[model samples]
Target: MKEIVIGENQAGQRFDKYLSKYLNEAPKSFLYKMLRKKNITLNGKKATGSEKLKEQDIVRLFLSEETIDKFSQVKVERSHGKLSILYEDKHIAAVNKPSGMLSQKASGSDVSLVEYLTGYLLESGQMKEEDFRCFHPGICNRLDRNTSGIVIAGKTLAGLQEMNEAFKLRSLKKEYLALVEGVVSSGAYLKGYLHKDEKCNKVVVEKEPFEGSVPIETEYRPLAGNQRVTLLNIHLVTGRSHQIRSHLASIGHPVIGDGKYGSKKSNQLFCDSYGVKSQLLHAYRLTMPELKGELNYLSHKVLTAPIPSDMKRVLEGEHIEESIHE
Candidate 1:
């Protein structure tokens, strides 16, 4: 028999959820069966899967050492690199994820931001390899492969939980800087419905309601403009898949350098002039709400990533603020 003591980071989750992290090889049905037979007990008593866990809670596993080891076997691989850090604390970190990089692994061979993050932690001695066996750190938020910007990561369980809740509750405001064809003279909030084609990995934004569509909102204000293109700051009201690109395109303002959902002539001209590759959209700003508990340091903090040089060169004559103080 073995007993595990819960820590602050492990608190507030269900007992079954916590156990699954350790006994990963065990099936959920078998785990439930074990719970019924008192093979797994919480604080010396049988616990239903719904029981909320707390700090200092003791979980006793009646299984032997060999059985536990067989079930909890995990393989960890080491990688090394420097990942740009926007903010970091004991509980969480905000990383500047670059375009062309996967936020998470696309496949077994893909090197992702999470790998770099793990490398940083290992090199900095923030975590050890064995810690991954029980509590693996993860990115709480994600960005598209071509969308460069800030991705909030959780270095601990409490941090991940709270950050995910913030995103789910829409407490965090995600903002972007986009260059599009035509001049946008003023700012306005747009509301519509969106439908996505998972097979094609594309989405359509409609002004009127559509079946199987979810509501979407977007607001944009022109920061600067020339005769052909305009730079705008985009506020994502409802962050659906490619909402900004599709919504903007549907309204005749497709983002510059976007091969998909954009004008071919505009793309060809910009590519020739600026060597534009992907869309000229950068996730530059993030507004965090009032935070509590372990992540109080991030309360009301506005995080911004510097615009890429390519974007700067595209709008060389336009006056734009590098950062948002508020």
Candidate 2:
């Protein structure tokens, strides 16, 4: 048997939910049965999963040690390379993920940012396998494999839960910088519906809704440009797979170097000139609103990842500065 004292972060959460995180190997039906049989108790009394937790409340978990380890310990091959950290705190961390790295995983052997961050915590001794025996720290957001930017990771359960809520509600704002083909003289708000083709790993943008289509909103302001290309600051109001690339292509301004949605001639020109293979887009900036209670430390702050070298060269050749912020 093990006892846990609810802290501010754990306070106000449902009792059953807390137990599920602790004894994850056990099923919900088993947990409910345990509660009914007085095996798992709240403050030394029988309780239901719906009981609202409070600070100083005591929770007793009555599972064997082996069972707990089976559910909580997920062994990952620790990455040896260094990570570019943007921001970090006791509850959370934000890192600059490179363009080629997988946010999670693409295959069984693939190493991911999630696994790396977990390994980071363990290496730093901030957490251990035993600590994760209940809850594990992880990235709260994801970036496409080829798109690089600020990736926020949760170091604690409260941080993870709060970050999930923030993203789900779109309270957390993200901004990206991209180089698109053609000169966009002015800014515009673009709204459309999109349908994704899973097999081809592509999307079709439509002016109207369709059977599998989902509504999307994108806003952009031209930062700098020349006749052949425009550098942009993009705000993704609704994030979907390939939303930016397809939407811009639908408007005849596909992102440069994007072979999927962009012109083959343009792609060939860039490849021949600069060896630019991936789309010239980067999720380089982020902003957060005022947060209360446990996550208050991150309130009203901004995070940024420096532009990659390839994109920088493109902007430079166009005679544009590194960036423009408003």
| Worst ten in a row by lDDT for model 2 | 68-77
RMSD of each: 3.3, 3.1
lDDT of 2 by residue, 108-183 (tens): 8899998888788888888766565446678888887878888999887788888888888888788999899998
TM-score list, all predictions: 0.85, 0.85
TM-score of 1: 0.85
Model 1 stretches astray by more than 4 angstroms: 1-4, 14-17, 27-53, 57-66, 75-79, 317-326
lDDT of 2: 0.84
* lDDT per residue (tens digit) for residues 1-326 in model 1: 99888877677888888778778898999789989999999999988878998889898999989989888967565568778898888888888888788889978998898888888888899987757766778898788888888999998988888998898888898899998999788988999999999988899888889899999999988877877788888988777888899999999999987877899999998788878888888889999999886677888998889887778888774454333343
* Cα error, candidate 1, residue 272 (Å): 2.0
